[model samples]
Target: MLKNLKLTTSIIMLSSLLVLVAGCGSKKANDSKKEISVALNSELSSVDVSLAMDNTSSDVMEQVGEGLYDFTAKGGVKPALSTNKPKATDHGKKYVFNLRKDAKWSNGKPVTAKDFVYSWRRTVDPKTKSPQSYYFDGVKNYQAIANGKKAPSSLGIKANGKYKLEVTLDRAMPYFPSILAVSASFPLYQPYVEKQGKKYGTDAEHTLYNGAFTLKGWNGSNGEWSYVKNKDYWNAKHVQLDKVNVKVYKTEQTMVQQYQAKKIQFTQISGSTVKNLKKDQDLTVRKIPGNQYLVFNVKENKLFANQKVRQALAMAVDSNKLTKHVLQDQSLPATGYVPYGFNNSKTGKDFAKQAGQLVQNNKTKAQKLWAEGLKELGMTSAEFSILSSNTETAKQVDEYLQSQFETTFKNLKVRVAAVPFNSRLSKQNSGDFDTVLSGWTPVYADPTDFLNLLMTNNNNNNGKWSNSEYDQLIKDANDKYALDEQKRWDNMEAANKIAVEQAPIAPLFYISQVYLKDPNLKGMMLGPLGQPYYKDASYK
Candidate 1:
């Protein structure tokens, strides 16, 4: 979530890369016991930890960088560069993270508290324009520094000594330690970042690794890259895979073909192809905490501005059909903005179960609402386009939505604009299209991460949808209702209900990562955030 925030895709570049993958399906054949081959759905967007925000970029950063803490595949936090979990004081607002004395960067520089302090300040700097900066909202003076009201140096974080870092927050953050594991909060190598200047993280050579692996031979332009074991990493002895070669295969068919030929040890398959692949014992399904939804530009499209019309559009789409037939991955249909697995802190019952299905298919009722909405707007017909990314799954979903919207509403002319993922994000940010088919991988496991987007003028609210009462509900969920578990969930449930009935955005499905891997591959654990943690991974 540049604070939902990451920053885009080049159309020509992706198309060219797809062609390259098709021609070189059997390329990069040098796999060994110390190494493995893998595939990425998208290229690394950027290498700069402070600037990296997309899921792909974040994944790459996970290999090459380490935060104070590292997230585990089993939904636990592990010590990484930090010697231990942060010591909290002031009722959880003040945290002091101690760095490991032996933790060293790839370049042999000791990892220090100063590096983290510099990285945090750099991200919050208004001039950096890092989208991830908004995640620092509650930190002391973050708003002031981010809004240019104060100097970056005055931000809450400070280094007590070379290895000790002290951070002050404005309020209690129950998941602050987990947030530290996110790539945006990772430490930066000051001398390297400063010397390389704007070119830092543009290539592997510019950035130094402190984690289990170091990005090697990545020129910042190629879709193919690799991560090799970093000899200087503190925990290098336990990292069994000496190297991981990552290739970006644009089409699912090509990716499957490559996987079948033993060229790609890991690759994603289209939902329609899953049945045939199930015979192969290595096929696996990993459900993730990500949501794919439709964001409507109420400000740009007068038709969408009518609450009734938005509700009609939402009701017409059957998420079950899309998930079962189209997705075919055992992916759960989304009930609310939040996914199904997360428990309500108060009840321990599933949050989605509590919220229930907000929008359901009601053809007769939806048609009536459509007619009434059109009449209310004093219009006989309206035309709008749905924007989406250029991916196999995205294409299928876009087609499904286009068919549903056009067939459901007699007077509506619907179109779809599919571009590369990064380009799709650019269009959404500029408010270029009507309803955009976009998704958010959770930055952290919290209802607030999803609910906060609906707040009026929130950075991730690309649709410009606003509701004063809804905003207050979310505000209370984060503030007055925070400490009280029951009240906080109540506030979240209330706010999400309002958003759903209003239909600013429509929930589609929670993502389930369906892929084919070599049977020999073991310990390749995919974490809750929808990324694989390769640190503990090794051959069976």
Candidate 2:
């Protein structure tokens, strides 16, 4: 076994932490190798894509589920389960997909086109209460089904034959192919899902794999899990790794210790430990196409209901200092909700730079706004607590924000509710908190993915921010401007401006995926959405 490797400074990466040392030739993969172990910051709860919106679930889904398309290293779309790209017709509103004949479920049943139809319909079904169903908005009748005006079966997706699938959209979409690459659009075999009932996706046994890996040894609560290669995979001959193992370790110290002890190949490190990593040759810092922000529950908190209060709080955030000192990574201070890396469809310049700064440090203006907001509400004092994940890095950022707010406004009592990641998501979704730190990554490469969430009644809009003008702008961007590339791009930028001005969510910083990877690992392509594809990855 090629166990020991000394890291040099010749590593390469793009948006996420996938590195390969320069001048190292590829080596033949040894299929008899044991599972490759890595660290996960949070626990893996579900492989059901509809119910699980978090990153860990998405990671697990990629191992077990195969989508119509997958992403390439150049931020481009590529075919996965389908033989190639879908054929577009009806002015790009209709897409026909041809599945590979060899694709089969872990149970030895052929993976048919109808599996995609059933899985998509199940996601948009009102009974499922899927938080991620909003991803289907532009699909034909998807919004109607989600809004309870149409039946789930009415969703405009059908299997044309045993191997061909047809998808009808409400309008022509330029980024539809990219959207299909996300985990939310993947298929699930119908019979197994029905047999397992609600317990499906809760553990390894209940779920079946159709992708490159078959998950095993996870009982839904264990901190350790493994992804064994699927022998029945259609392209199993190309899958280089025999198995990949994951262990949940929240402490940065433990991850570092594990890596140094040669027990793992990669781990994410943050805080002061970043200083230590700069000297280590294995360090590779990469930006993820996402932004961290704070969402407020306007319906529950009267103070937060006032736009002036929200704006005041937003302007007072000093993200530049936070990213520089606290995060200590190469993360940038976010100018708006949309990430900085996305290119404008018209000008080809950066989207975030073109949109400009939505909110910034202006203590005097913030103070004036706060006073006006308090007077409008006829109150002198107000208090609110922030809900945040309990990870070490999250704790540092949350503590910084709490101290800043409490010190800035004497009348405002700011508290931090640090809970486990799953608990935090539950609390935020139920509208049980005054404020919470959250984030969103683009499902595709389009700016609309981040901008559309603030539209009226969007599923992820837990803040209950309703603005008719903002909603109209988003509608025009996704609907009216669908055909004109420049017009749609302009509308998306305008919508993000409205979201920033209203301050329902305060943009903080663009999150970076920091990795300490072994130099020998090759062919791991980290997609624009922060997912790593290891289909062709192998040790050199």
For model 2, residues 1-540, the per-residue Cα lDDT tens digits are: 000011010011133321111111112122224346665787776788678677777767767778888766766666788887855799878988899999988988999999999999999998987877888888999888978899988998999999999999998776677668767888888989999999988888988889899988899888677778898888899998887777777788877876766666667777677777888998877766678899988888998999999998998889998889888877788888887766754566777888888768787888889989999999998888889888888889898888778777778889889888778878888888899988876666667777777877787888888999888888997889787767777787788888888898989888777767766667766655445565667765
**For residue 420, what is the lDDT in candidate 1?**
75
Which pairs clash inside model 2?
Answer: none
TM-score of each: 0.91, 0.92
User: What's model 2's overall lDDT?
Assistant: 0.76
Cα RMSD to the true fold for all candidates = 5.7, 6.1
Per-residue lDDT over 404-503 for candidate 1, one digit per residue giving the tens place of the 0 to 100 score: 9889888889888888766776687778888998777666556777787777856678899999999888777676765677788888888878988899
Candidate 1 regions exceeding 4 Å error are: 1-31
